[model samples]
Target chain A: MYVSMRKLIQLATVAFATLVAGASLAADKGLTFGMLMVGPYNDHGWSQSHYEGGQYVEKKMPGSKMIYIDKVNPADRPGLTIPMVVDDLVEKGATVIVGNSDDMKDGMREAAQMHPDIKFIHISGDDVLTGKAPANLSNLMGRMVYGKMMSGYVAALSSKTGKIGYLGPLINEETRRLAVASYLGARYAWTEVLKKPLADLKFQVSWIGFWFNIPGVTADPTQVARNFFDTGYDVVLSGIDTVEATTVAEQMRKEGADVYSVPQDYIGSCETAPASCLGVPYYNWGPDYVKLFSAMQTGNWKPTWTWSGPDWTDINNPDSSAIGFVKGSALNAENAASLDQFIQGLGDGSISLFSGPLNLQDGSVYLKAGETASDKQIWYLEQLLEGMDGASK
Target chain B: MRMQGLKRHLFEIGLILGMVVLFTTLLLSLVGASPLEAFSHLFAGSLGSWAKFSRVLNVWIPLTLCSIGLLYAFRTGLWNIGVEGQVVMGAIGATAVLRLGLEASHPLFYLLAALLMGMAFAALWALFAGWLKVRGGVHEIFAGLGLNFVAMGFVLWVIFGPWKRDGIASMSGTQPFPLELWFPSLPGWRVSPFALGLTLAIILLTAWVLYRSRIGLNLDAVGRNPRAVRLFGLSPSRYMLLAIMVSGALAGLAGGLQVTGIYHRLIPSISSGYGYLGLLVVMLANFRLAPVPFIALFFAALNVGSIQLPMMMQLDSSLAGVIQGACVLSALLVFGLRTLRKRGPSDE
Candidate 1:
């Protein structure tokens, strides 16, 4: 008994010494955040925004250190499972982990359960603190739908055939609501504001399951653009990051389709397609990046959705307003005037995306047939009306 | 002398090391990175912490299992090259069970389904080669190669057609299997216990079976000369088919563990180059059981390290491919020299 007492006393001393050492280290250490990117930091698409966000945090916080790992194709299996990556990051001293993909939800959930001290912020997923997850795990998505609506107006105004098609990725809540916003915005401009008969307008929307070109599929935006133009829709809108849709517009120009295009990140699409592109609906992803991390630093970040978009201004706007590039390839006179009018109206808020009596493609009442939908209800949109061609359960 | 063989191996390892250094240096230079900086980045990225070591094991476990399995067939001189197909078919079988609601509440049933179905599926695929080799006097390699294309066709047909996710792009996968069915991720380890355990069991069992049994001696004779074994009253075809069966079963086990333990669903990406890598490993180890894991881990380190190198070095992940090709080439050179010396002028 006496020998055992001596061992217990020794164990207690080691525990106490380690505890005090940990306490001292906690105050001295810099806060480390990990960013898990689906593509290279320079991808210029989804990963670029997250990289910029990490840089924003680096600039904003004095003592916060950012570490990143990228090109984490979910297929690099075994130890590279998304959750495994999260666990490794947390184990390596990151207090907060940022996973920039929706497919990472299960991984984030599993990692959060394993390490309660580590906070995981999964982008564009529906899972948050309450159901099937804990307080440490949450999700955030930007309201790019508002930006998509603005792009829709650009297409609606540019269309000469009175028909326009929107090419989007996946029929999930994100793409579905964005597609709805695009059509609703266009119909608002074409029918309600222009005082045109509802039956005179034609709009179509289709979705491909992924964000970029699917090599073997007919869903390539460039191909879909030809589909729309051949079917008499002169204007095309793209909801994906790849420049395929704009490339299709460039192709259409070769044959005199006179079809216009709204490509997002308009300035950056040149890697593949050229500047016949109209303005893009780009994300001013800077604000939320600054806001969320600052809140995290102050221990004030909460599980609430923040929508930051629709800031239509010059490309140089600190908000980086989603700008439509003026038609670069010889904008013949009348088209220029039409494009400017659309831009000027959007800039002043004289044009609204959801001033609706949003009707189905079959002319059936969706939002009370003749009355406009409220700003609040538009944010919670669920389904696509008739002009859209996709389904989700 | 064996000492001469040792010196030759050492020289060959040096040549492989030189090739890898030159390979990465060229890649980094082309990407506008200083090769010195890229080397430092490679070191820092791969050996940066213990977590990275865990990532190495995650890759090592599966690769080791596959290499050891391939070693079995190579020992008996049967070119059981359909390992890739057998692995995929086996994974598809296990996933089909989960799709039918055979949940992991019955662990024994799940494990048995995984192993038995893997063996059965792989055996069925192997039967093609067996039939061709036995009945038509055909080469198993060509038959096995054709079967691989069929497996790939099967995977694509499901992804784009019937098994497609509703309204989702035809991404190469099924829904993640129910979590309860996943093999336990080892505590503080990225690899599943099932992978590590099964690989170890197969390595040990194979070493014992091939080295200690009388059938092993007959297999050696059959591999050396079927006519000699035929006069010895042994059926060489039976031993040859047995060797292929063992090879396919182990490869199928690897596939089932991959989908269930690692991927959580069948993915078009799962086979990767593991079966091919396994072939290189068997050749390098000279089909010895003891050194297979070490060789597999060396390749695994290249894979795990490549992910980190791209960011720090500005080099593409394909640089790992260059290093792997270099290693295999060097090992082949050493084997070629050893074999030539055995038939040198003195023997002639």
Candidate 2:
């Protein structure tokens, strides 16, 4: 009895010391960052890039710690709802929670309204812009529209059969805008850059109606991509949140089909299929978040609707930019040089694809001749521009 | 003697639960988490607040209804694994009625009509599976599973093709039903008093039907010996079909409540695997009615509390599933051992 009592006293002392130390450590921690991901951390696409951004914040900032909840999507983890996730994260001492993905918009907005003290950064949503979000919530997204245009330009130049197929995921303003931008780039590169007739170049976009591949609800992207190859779309561009384009292209290439693919949302995604990847138009979220984190630490953070583009000087810089297009192994040297020139022209304001005589899918005038499209028009693009052979409505 | 038997049963249940707790703690320790803190967080997150407990009740309503519905089918010796499909079909039915723009009418009429439509649609779906099992000589498991996939495809087509909002399809689901069609909530909580009352009614009804009705004896007879049921001049298939339909209707009503009470729209994952979870609940209840609601609430607590694992402890929420699976497994083990002992030493 004496030995057991002594042991219990010793254990209590150790527990008390550890509790105090933990409290002190938590108090001293500079900024606690939490991230919510819709997919696994290593998905090689959207979620992976967000995870890397979290890692970058941890590395670049001092006296800070980070935690992330991955695979938080409802389709797989049905029992976990967004409000529950948010409450738990807030209880665990997260000052700022980054709700990644447009699918998480409702949950993010609801949580932000419920918890006004904690800050929320929602990526790729118009809730902030439309004045529907709480003051504590801000929307941040990259200008991937331009990068997707660049993808179209490269895919057009490299395609042997001028037919390009876009594996689309859902029909929304964001997706419609991106698909239209790619077609714009494809038409310009085909008629002006490649000196090909407009009739010879074809771009077809198919909608799967979800961000990732859901087997039953959405069409299988891999099968759709393989069909694109089988039916003569030599260059397929991925608009979904998976590296299936590169993987599918690599498999088809092995089977002796001349096919190439453009991946979305990551610079290093070419490693998935080196021989088939043309390039990737990836979101570099680290820099903007780091700035926000710094400003927040100093108590000067203002909720801004950030629709940032790439750094003109160094597109590959991990800071101060939202969008970057990374060239891959399959891009030929000559094609790469031309694509670089095109990007430089875009940077210098010499080439303007949005400059107009543009028409809607119904042959209605969208932009008057010599009138450039405004940010609102581009951001809320309503339809697939005229001449794309696919359903926009 | 009765008291002694009850005591032995209670003691065995306690032993199984103790084994489950020990196993789960050992697993958490393997993942480098303090098991005590993990368990405390779970209890606090699930039952520590009125809001949290209400959410647990919200989950419990659907799970309990589905489990009780499944019990009817189980007692009739029918494997109605397509309860998930029935739930989806229910949502579709409710959504169709709400689309009629009849919110200006009496709210109770709208609610009753929507729920009835939901049950009717789900009954039709379940009857199709029953037909396949009886006529085609196909296994009910395969038929139910296949029909579930078909129901998913049907929902997808409706959301994308016919009922798409404003000429575009999205993952956000069909446009929300007008506010008037939404189920009235309890004064200060997210859950509806109507929904809670509905659940209680269903539970009491199911218990009465199972314990004090002639149909209960027929179902039991069908499960044990269909030939014996036939000797009584009652068609076994008719009773089996009745069991499947009643199960589907309950699941469908739960789905309807989800649309009118919770989400207010038909999302793709509206059912969210509650059908499967309900199966687990019934299994853990040892195929009895009285213990189902309690078992379901326990499941809900585990599921709702597990969100904290990922948030507070950086642990995977799948660990909740592991704990639940372990509990059921230990119960099964204890039950098997009891049966062996009852059979005497020579039987083994």
Candidate 3:
């Protein structure tokens, strides 16, 4: 091949640029982290929390590079699959992979088995407990039931109608448990704390099938929230993955309806409807992610299933907490102080909410008198507890 | 003249493909990424390893079958945008048969029944749109889109009201059929060889039907000159209806295989835009059956491999869609320029 003098010089320049680029990449010894989100990163809800957690890992761990792909579920991104995403991340030097939804369970498991050296932390999936999860795979979740209970308590305290509504997503065990925990908190505050009869307090829930609207499968959460407000419910607690509850409540408030909402997933969701958002029960994933990534850095990474609760002393702590209950602007001074006292009681182990003569929706006894439910029992709750008005199957 | 035409087509294809590469590279560089690294990661994710390549083929088989079927409708100048609805209806049909728990007595019989039922359901769905287009003078595009929304609603209802697991509905989909009813997989692989073989066979059958038969010629006449079909005493509407129904049947069968072979249950996303992707593939192939499968495979590779861009390079997967659009746009532009140059001022 005959090469001109100018072509040779051009080739030399390209080679030098390539060499510099390669050296810059090799200079970073930081552990690379990859997150696969089920929704858009700026969705202002579930996926956003995971996105912030990934960012937190970079800031806290120092020398760690964080990368994330949003809207990853196959249903949303039709052509992309989870195994492909996991494989690509591993090839890009990401040793710590986070699959941020239950839908990612199968792919996370398969990826963990295929790449044993990489650590896979699947959030909110029981595949680790139910399936023979690979050694490199772990399940990380929060005891959001406590945060949910606080939301219910705040709703009950703020409600002028004594009827607090919960905008629930689907009829799953996870969703059902969360709704019932809210009911428990509502009933406790209404009957004991407020010295009112239990019969006078109404805690109703309406489910919209999925985490968000699917047009046909799930009813629109916005309309559902409107319906709850229309039906005389003064406060609506969200159990879905969107800010529709608070946003709708804010609109209704502007229309001069005295209503409040509790948003879920991200702590900053109250900013979407400051006047109507009473509080938000959100997942604080930073502490958990840092725990996993720090272990990986020390070469002592071992996959351990973790389900941590919030530090009751400081629910808003950005670190050392799995869930946080951020009081929104709508919370009044009296209710806010009571909520703080309730959190202190919860942290000191003085409160026992699950202990009961609890009945399932079918009138079957779930917990006998004075019986305390175990973690396994709570994790696999099959139906809504009695005294809650909702469909439970 | 034929030799000249062949040479021109080859030249146009090469030029368009080169332009597509150039534009996509420019896009990557503009986003502060190394175009070489991005392209390499994409290919590696799609075709580098056996497992990864299998995933590409897994998407390719259904997309190709759907595109080949679409080629039939296009030949008759009919746009079958409702293929997605047809796929959903097919899945519902298969689920109806599979939920009967007939796997133990006669597995093969039930499997075949499910496949046929799926095709029947889709054909019927497509025929409704055809009826509206012919008798009601409605546009096929609008009719097909309306039916697609109805099909989605129908699937959601079935999942929530009828086939809901344990009387509770969620996005997890229906319960899996008995293990024996599940589509047999290739040993130690995610791809179902039987499904793959069946899809390829159907594609060949469509090709033969569209290219070798008198029916294909009649459909072409109806599309190009309806007056000729009337002169031959053939009903143009009938042929148009046949073309759309066949397209729907193929799309439906793809949906059936998806439920039985891959997911083993009908979710709301059972179709997952394979019908739409098939439309893109057919367009990219210039509406020709000969290149449909190849184009479908290439598109699938782009989509499945684009995961690498997001995972490794922090770029959105939508980059793949942009590349596909650019390729189609460039090819169409080349086609327009060639036609413009070929015609003298007298033609205009």
Candidate of highest TM-score: 2
Q: What TM-score would every model get versus the actual structure?
A: 0.82, 0.87, 0.85
Candidate 2: misplaced stretches above 4 Å? Answer: A1-30, A60-65, A254-256, A291-303, B1-45, B48-50, B101-109, B130-142, B178-181, B184-190, B214-238, B313-348
- Model 1 vs. true fold: TM: 0.82
DockQ scores for all predicted structures: 0.23, 0.39, 0.36
Q: What is the C-alpha lDDT of each candidate?
A: 0.67, 0.84, 0.83
lDDT of 3 by residue, A1-393 (tens): 357878999999999999997876564457798889988788789999999998888888778888788887656677455766777677678888999877666667767877888888999877768766887888899999899889988988898899988898878777888998898888778877898898888888898888877665578999999999999999999998878888899998999999999998897899979888888889989988988777776667766778889887687888877899888988999999999988888889787688778898889999999999998888788998877888986
DockQ, candidate 3, vs. native dimer: 0.36
Candidate 1, residues B1-348, lDDT tens digits: the string is: 877756765566566667668876786677787888766655654556666776677677667867876766676687777878877777777766666654546764675576568667876777767667867888889888888878867865675566666545445366777777777765666666666777778778877887887877787787888888899899888877877777777777777777777777766656665777788877776676776888787777776666555544446655655656777776777678768877898753
Ranking by DockQ: 2, 3, 1
Top model by lDDT, which number? 2
Model 2: what TM-score?
0.87
Worst 10 residues of 2 chain A by lDDT: A74-83
The CAPRI classification for model 3 reads as acceptable
In model 2, what are the clashing residue pairs, if there are any?
A: A170-A209
- Superposed on all Cα atoms, the candidates' RMSDs to the truth, in angstroms, are 6.2, 7.4, 8.0
Model 1 misses residue A374 by how many Å? 8.6
Give every collision pair in model 3: none
